[model samples]
Target: MSLSLVLLFLNFFTPQFNEAGQAKLEKMVKDRDALTAQWKASESQKSGIFGNRTKKDMIETNEWLERIIKKDNLIMDELRMIGDIETITATQTGDDYKAIAFKQEKDVQALKRAVAERDKQLKEKLSERRTFEWISLILFLISLGLGFVVYKKVIKP
Candidate 1:
């Protein structure tokens, strides 16, 4: 009975004794490795916001809007030469549109600059975090190595 019990325990725990579990464990390990690789690749491609954003995330300014307004105003002014009624209506709407568009353009340009600045700050923060992680890993490994050395010298008889 004791021998049988020992055999059962070995059969349950040993990988070779449990081929199905062993295969499953190997597949799980492989899947875990694949997932880790994918995560790393994705992280490397990220703007550091959990890889959820794109270059559009960087555009938070209205300078571009101002540019568009200036361009549209030129075209609108040119359109005025084609008709006197159009010239008057264009003048009436032009100031209001230009003013509003200018403000909006400035706001958009400012927003874009702000988002770019935010991304730069985030990049610095991530760089610091990576440095800390490396330092900690190195320290952990050194401590482990020291502990092994101390154990071998003082405890192993």
Candidate 2:
């Protein structure tokens, strides 16, 4: 289970996940280039019509502009769709990361609680040991005092 989690974590950093993204980006660039070229061609055509200054020339120029605008709108729509897909993928990846981070945080908290419990037990044992030592010392001193009293009263008197 942990191994799978590690692999899932590593998968995000790999190029395979980005391959689809790279392709989408390339498509967008190509479409942009094509749109630019079309725009330039339309501009050149409109410029050529300037010298004539006739009603027919104006109509033709307007028509060309209209067609260019329509094509531009279509290209913009495509770009927008690509952007939406990228946004969704990013959101999903972010969610995955958040889940993994939350799990790791929970694990850390559990380990900290275990360590605190162990430390508390150790402290209790240390306190008990100190109490036992104090009691033993008091008993030993009492026995020595009693032996000295016996020597003075029985042997000396």
Measured by TM-score, the strongest candidate is 2
Give the TM-score of each candidate. 0.43, 0.57
Steric clash count of candidate 2:
0
Encode model 1's per-residue lDDT on 1-157: one tens digit a residue.
5544654554455434345444554565565566555545544454636666456433422334444455555545444433444455457456655766888899999999999999999999999999999999999999999999999999985
lDDT of 2 by residue, 1-157 (tens): 8645755765665444457656765776676577667656655553345454566556765776676576667667766765776676677678777887999999999999999999999999999999999999999999999999999999999
Model 1 poorest 10 in a row by lDDT: 56-65
On a 0 to 100 scale, what is the lDDT of residue 83 in model 2?
71
For model 1, what is the C-alpha lDDT against the true structure? 0.62
Model 1 segments more than 4 A misplaced? 1-89
